[model samples]
Target: MSAEGEQYGSSEEEDMYSDDGQEMEEDEQGEAPAAQAQPVLGPKEWVGLASMPAATQQALLNALGKLRGRNVNEMTVIFIGKQGVGKSSTVNTLLNERVAPSSPFQPENVRPLLAGRMAAGFTLNVLDTPGLLEGDSVSARGLMALRAALNGRKVDAFVFTDRLDTWRVDNADRAIFTALAENFGAELWERTILGFSHAQTTPTDGKPYEQFVAARVEQYRAAVRSTLGMKNLALPYVLIENGSRCKTNGDGEKVVNDKPWVTDMVSTMVDVASVGEGYEYDHSKAGKKLDPNNKHKIWILPLFLIQVFVLRPLLIGQIKRDVKKAESKAKGKK
Candidate 1:
């Protein structure tokens, strides 16, 4: 087996490569033009707004109001990350409604879900996607599913969710950054907001909470930079605690590290959208498909030519010379 096979497996049905070939072919050929922006028929009312603390509600309204000032009446945000990383819970917390089914023990299905909410003549659409990783590799099936869900819709920003309690970032974490850049485009990163969920955890390293948060943010920023080769990538981050046990401030707003995380998260989303235009899905921007089996096969022709033209001729001449020497020696002896 080749080195890639040993590392990722040779099976055609391997999780990383499964269903990716077709998706990549479609991408390479350029899928249909960006779908027309269809209205989210009969969006649900923002009932959760009334339940939020008055201060948080006003803060959210004020942040979204800035988007209105920019004439962006409708905003769409997508959530993506590894499985069971509180993606759905974050969505629920942000919208203040249980629109996406979430569970700690069981991972959601591979299907993507879109939930739209309307408030004060503004529309907010959130797309919750399946986990992007399967085992140690990026799951092509999950990417394919997310692409289908998007269907060329314009996205204002992306919320990349992960657990803050996890101390280490591994190759799998970096692979996600590469996969996203390859499948969707490097431009997506510019509009992405790093959402560190489970933000209410105590630092086991005995570091100050702010210091620990800063270190964690830098770790992920470095990963994104190294993986995507974007050394200057500026990633805006939001600390999130999706648990019901999260502490509340005097105004009844959920607080993480004494800050109203929900308000800050929403404000950051608005900031991301205001900085750039909405990202419309374009398959043409996708990177060329990588064939794992044929990745390093370019050396095959050169090696083959050496074996047949150079090595074969040398071997044949050597054999004839040896045979003639043997015959001459036998005749002399006779």
Candidate 2:
């Protein structure tokens, strides 16, 4: 079979026609295939469909010929981490625009905010959260606000941001991961991607990427993985150096190298952001099916009428009765 033909087949057939088909067959029958056996479609292929014009839907179908895999739908990416970690910068880069503000905020300190847009008919929302250790008294309130913002929303993936140079095995990072797991459930860990920003801070020794990941500056990576019960604990992560500097010549013309880490980091962000394929966003359905317009609005009309006509009067009467009871109790106590 041709390569295109094989692309449209089951795993068994896809492997059977390949160079290591025999090995895959044996592994399938006796033991599970290695984790690396199944090739993950690259980030480019995943996002290609969404980037295509919707008017080309028929042409896309004919050219691709019955896509065997999933489709990208409404995706939400939440950036959670410490202060000054470039969460907003990463978000702006992924969006390829300045949709998110990057400058720091004071007073109450930087807090989480939600920004959304519709791209290629897919509604994409990215939530930028405040640092885990912003204030002492606002922890519970911050958590509640985070929950409220995420309420009635289906999160497809989370981008956990941390600083490679400033990371530490501290309570703040631990609390952040704990709160994340508690709120989103541990399953979200699998969908999580650790983004280590400020890679330029590392020494210019030109070491391998693997060595950088091994240094364990803060253990944020390991801590989050362990919290999620991941056995390997390495977890997939990306390193980025977002800050840039430029030098000017006599003519006041400036040249830039940008940040070397930016390329790889952007690639990884694209991958993490692309995971929302095949998932729909319908807040009314508890994350099932696309809501599409105000179709669900009709279902609430009768309930609203009942509340207005019957429940409201009953609720008022109950409030009056409770107030009388409280007054009687106060008198008896006196």
Candidate 3:
């Protein structure tokens, strides 16, 4: 079977797949589930679809077809990470076009941008967001921009990007993960695809490539689990190399760790979408407790009532009693 003709499931990810977002059922006699009904998706002219490698285009089609079979007609994936981590590059690479602006010297603006494409009645919307971190902290402006950009759209999945070549996961990593969970809710992890960009780098420590990748993945997994307090969190990850010099297989598709990352990414996305849940962003719900204008406002009236109606009367009575006692003491002295 050809690369796309065969099922595109990654052998390395088979174990992770069963644990990550897939839901299954068993009959009374424990018979295998029947095949899903593959609904027809009307073909639309996606601008970059035809330009991608034949294998990549076929893999994408298969993934989208799986979604259509499960009655999902649209998929919205948002890419988010710190500055210069290749979020925009991943977006461009996945869509097979430069739909997003990615420049090493030029930083993305605080505002996020959403780009959409259509093929075979399946709509794919990708939101490329600004860097969520500013120096060591989460950027408030970026969070506000992301919330506004989403504009209450239902996000089917999130691709959280980071550098696979980074040597360590520090407090900054934990802070970003916590900030996302706080602003977007812990449910975001349920549909998250951890995209470790710059996957084509060699380890400086002289370790084997696969071993280095595993260690890096574990570092992120530990950080997310520790910071979010979700010990059982199963974070599915995909390695991505978006550079022009990335190595390609015989099919002219980008390969990392001997697997075509584009196909793996799309297949993983389809799995997450099949989990039957999408994150609904509510502008009113996010950052309310942290917003100074709204935080503690409800307690303002109650605090004022306690000060005036409760404390003032007691204070006045105590003063009057002190005055009478002073007068009585004066009389006794006389």
Using lDDT as the measure, the top candidate is: 1
TM-score on alpha carbons, each prediction? 0.77, 0.50, 0.73
> How well is each residue in 1-334 modelled by candidate 2, as lDDT tens digits?
0111001122553321111111122134332222222422311222323443343333333322222123544456677766677886766544444434575662322334554544344445556665555443224434433443344445666777877766366665666666655544565565677777766554445666456556753366667666666656434677665564433234322212232343344345445545544222222322211112234578798999999999999999999999999999999999
What are the per-residue Cα lDDT tens digits for candidate 3 across 137-222? 67765665455445446788888889999878888778778767777678888788889999999999999999999999988888
* Candidate lDDT values, in order: 0.75, 0.49, 0.72
Off by over 4 Å in 3: 1-44, 287-334
TM-score of candidate 1 to 2 decimals: 0.77
What ordering of candidates by TM-score runs from best to worst? 1, 3, 2
RMSD (Cα, Å) of candidate 1? 9.5
Off by over 4 Å in 2: 1-69, 105-111, 119-122, 135-138, 204-210, 227-229, 232-234, 246-334
Query: Taking the candidates one at a time, how many backbone clashes does each contain?
Result: 0, 1, 0
lDDT of 1 by residue, 37-156 (tens): 233244567777877889988998999999999878888888999998899788778877766667666547555666677888888877777788877877766776566555557788
In model 3, which residue pairs have backbone atoms overlapping below 3 Å?
Answer: none
Q: With candidate 2 superimposed using the best TM-score fit, by how many Å does residue 72's alpha carbon deviate from the native?
A: 2.4
